[model samples]
Target: MSSAQSSMQLSNVSDPLRVHVPPNETPEERKRRIAAEKKAKKISEAIDKQLKAERDEMEKTRGTKLLLLGSSESGKTTVLKQLKIIHGKGLENEREQYRHIVHLNVLTAIKALAKGFEVNNLTLENSENDEHLAAILSLSSIKESLNRQSLSLQAAVGGLKSADDATAILLANYESVKAVWSDSAVQKYFESANDIGLQDSAKYFLDNVDRLAQENYLPTDEDILQARIRTLGVTEHKFDINSTTYKIYDVGGHRSQRQYWAPYFDDVNAIIFMAAVSAFDQPLEEDLRINRMRDSLDLFNTICNHPLFKNTSIILFLNKIDILKKKLNRLQLKTYFKEYQGANDFQSVTKFFRREFLSRNKVVDKNVYVHFTHATDTTQMRVIVASVNDMIQRENLKASGLI
Candidate 1:
């Protein structure tokens, strides 16, 4: 057989299987098939249009989402609480919730003062306080024990009333706390409380020891605002302003808790980045070697230049200005921030830190609104929050091309 004749034979064998045969359809059947396809197409189009309308409605009704980002003890939670008091319902009903926390604050402050005394090699002025010091230190040891065994600070403190003897210990030794807190040497240590990592509220609580120790004492609004508790995870609060709902998220600022932050980056309209200007002389509780102000600056730089937040409006809150002002009167900013050459006065120091934070923004077009805030002052925060809300609304409108 020739090669051409063999190829022809192979084609004949494969052609039958390769060819596709359509079944014959009547005219009526053809009409029904086309009509069915058109009906399906109409349904799909209607579904798509309905979905688009739903999405538009949702976008119209959605509220502004703001993230409060800051280092631990930078007053983020205080800001949140102020907002709750100003916009949402007042903290009147919630005052009782913080009674134990107020007690804990006193305990924590005294323990820090005691530790400061030990670290500074200073003795209590009153030798009689030696017994009281022992009692206070015993409470400190109990706190440490509860912290180690409990999964969270809330759990540990919550157990203070029932699951543990910390409350009794605290009550029994609160008078001791008062005694140690009043010691001349302890007061000297408290002068550098920032250096010793004492909370900003320590002075307030320690000052009101007698009032707080009253049998039925409830935390006042100021006490609740000043109470320092380390935020463990993410907290959300919602309030309405000018018919627009606003959701504020307060996330833990510790390094360990930072992992929970990225999940909230998406769809965030604004970020309120708080830096404790007073923390210039202090160290981070998480890493004692790193200065708290330096850590805040580094974190601010990262967030300002982050790809995810390139377009997100940023509000820089130089919080704890009151503390910073007091500290500057005694401690020089240049001592901690070596690059600082300005005077130790409040104006010069604040201007320098503001410049430092603004200089970190790599995006030339991005504007960071800076505010010097005292988070505990409700009157001041009321004004700041109003301005912030206006700025956010304007920014959102601009983003949507409505401006």
Candidate 2:
């Protein structure tokens, strides 16, 4: 064979067995060629080694990551708190932190009730309630001023101090709060507090005013779960279950805060989407023109059909079932959701919402597991969490071809 033909044949051979030598090469040139080949091989091996190390590191650090998403007041944070109580370290260390929040919840409830009375043009049952209303309103004004000032100062001062002062004021006028809340006219508005933008926890706090007014009260786990605070940014919580580390990300659910959600979507194993089923009669806190339930359905549809989350498991939490149960007797589901033709019972309403959410999955064959949950119920949440854990693990195994 000719020299060119031989060289081509040698080049096509496998790397380990192949040797390329020019037909008319000098001894010195041959030595240099060998040295060059040795150096190229070493560099290639080094690159392979580095890439393997990186892969190993990624595998070692990889864990199950769950993203919690929803509209405002949809119980996303409460679910997170429940996980902390059940699977992770309990909330004993954060009792004091929650104490102030719980106290603030009481004040917020009273203020909301006081405002509700005016909005509905209702009068107090007794003239004595006028003095009580004045005290509550005065305290509320002070709190609002402190809040505005704190915002102007970028919250550097007077935030926590204002909460503390409000708590003290609440304790001082404990009887007044009780008296105003007990007024028959105020109760009428309180019954429709959701329509007037009251927090879901207001009733719980208002009902427990006597216990909350105590000097040395620390919040119970249930109390902590009932507390409502708008999540401003993203929060990461880590816990271990069954020898697997779990990283749960709770991002703000407000429309403005949703811009921060995309970064967490890339590597998520599952998403727990919360929706307050009880909010059918309520409007969005951000935009009063839109009904809260309608907003949730639209948001869920977007997330459920997003291309990036095609392979990610979605766990839909129809949260606040307790509130829905209470509201059904007072507010008609068909009033807000005109398309809801089903009867206005808990089963019909919950199933209707569940179908609405599931129908949002435009992706072919995508399954969304639905759960009707009261996030503040610790026992019920424990069972749901376990079921979610098992489902995620099964999905992960299927993805890895290990099942």
Candidate 3:
């Protein structure tokens, strides 16, 4: 191992970070800390003075929260990135605030974790050929990305969402330097849903993020790294979501991860259910989209039926339609809602899901509808995302008599 790794293993801050104290200070120097604290407090107030206090109450997200819950890789994070660009400056503080409240602390722990790691780390299952790169994410690393929070775009879905789910997903994948990873030993040895300890670790990690920032050692580099990515990888531009600003909660679509979706429903206000077009019939190796959709839909049924989410507004996004550009037809999609255009191809597959899955329980009381697009190909995904956003906003309006 490199010196860095060796130093890191020994560097775990088992206790809280140390206070920055000057060397060989006399009793009189203790007052220096008081002065310093006052000065720092003044600086913070001055910087924030430019921003208005009723910021949250001024625009769309103030009253309503939107959650992006769907199968993994459904482009929820990408959509939030799009919103950051569209609402730039206007929602800059909101985005930063969300990141601050959500992702700050464990970022420190992740740094500590990565410090102990060496490049080219890998683990074997049965043989060297079966080995793979070490998993980088940990429950502790998720920080504020989980936990209960007030609301944002994700609130539009249901209360189950915490921060922007989509944003958190991409943040986890950002440059190795910007974000930290779980030590290979920890990831391989202890990370699992069944590992009840992870739940506590997740809670503890969030508490630190909240506590550290409250003490003003916040807006750290990793926090800024997440903020810098606020507008990263988004494709939507014309989508006029509620007041043109949104906080989207993204959900994992994998079978193993689906169970995590339930706890987020308590506070969400809106929902975007993503269905990937390209994932429909692809083999598992080709993509997990198909299974993710089926699993997600089943989960959606669970969410909608939940007493708290029964009245929530939900918009269904048919993500990844670009992959089917050569194969798709509007007329064909219309057939999905019809009795028989020979329910085949994309329409048939989706129709079967809707009819079987959504109709089975039938508890959803708020507006619910499906639209299609490819999340990656902006040309098509743009329309789908926009349509979903607009539709959900309209539902909110109709319910509130705002329109």
For model 3, the stretches where C-alpha displacement exceeds 4 angstroms are: 1-63, 85-245, 255-263, 282-290, 324-343, 346-357, 401-403
lDDT of 2 by residue, 1-403 (tens): 9999999997777786567678999999999999999999999999999997896567547868889999988998888888889887898997877777777777767876786676567788899889999888777434552221011111212444654665677788899889998888888767766655577877788899899889999899989888777777898988777666788899888888899999998988899999989888888767889998899999999998898899888999999999889889878888888888899899888889888888888998786899999899999999998898889889977986869
Candidate 2 lDDT at 98 equals: 74
Residues 41-104, candidate 3: write the lDDT tens digits.
Answer: 8998977764544443464444455656665545565555444444443244554554543443
- Per the 3 Å backbone cut-off, how many clashing residue pairs does candidate 2 have? 0
TM values, all candidates: 0.82, 0.82, 0.41
Candidate 1 per-residue C-alpha lDDT over 74-176 given as tens digits, one digit per residue, 9 for 90 to 100: 8888888898899989888877657766766667667767765766677788999988887766663445422220123574466465423444556788778
User: Could you tell me the TM-score of candidate 1?
Assistant: 0.82
The 0-to-1 C-alpha lDDT of every candidate, in the order given, reads: 0.80, 0.81, 0.46
Model 2: pairs clashing at backbone N, Cα or C within 3 Å: none
Ranking by TM-score: 2, 1, 3
Give candidates' CA RMSD values in order.
Answer: 11.7, 7.9, 28.5
Q: Runs in model 2 with CA error above 4 Å? A: 1-60, 140-162
Lowest lDDT 10-residue stretch of candidate 2 = 147-156
Q: Give the number of colliding residue pairs in candidate 3.
A: 34
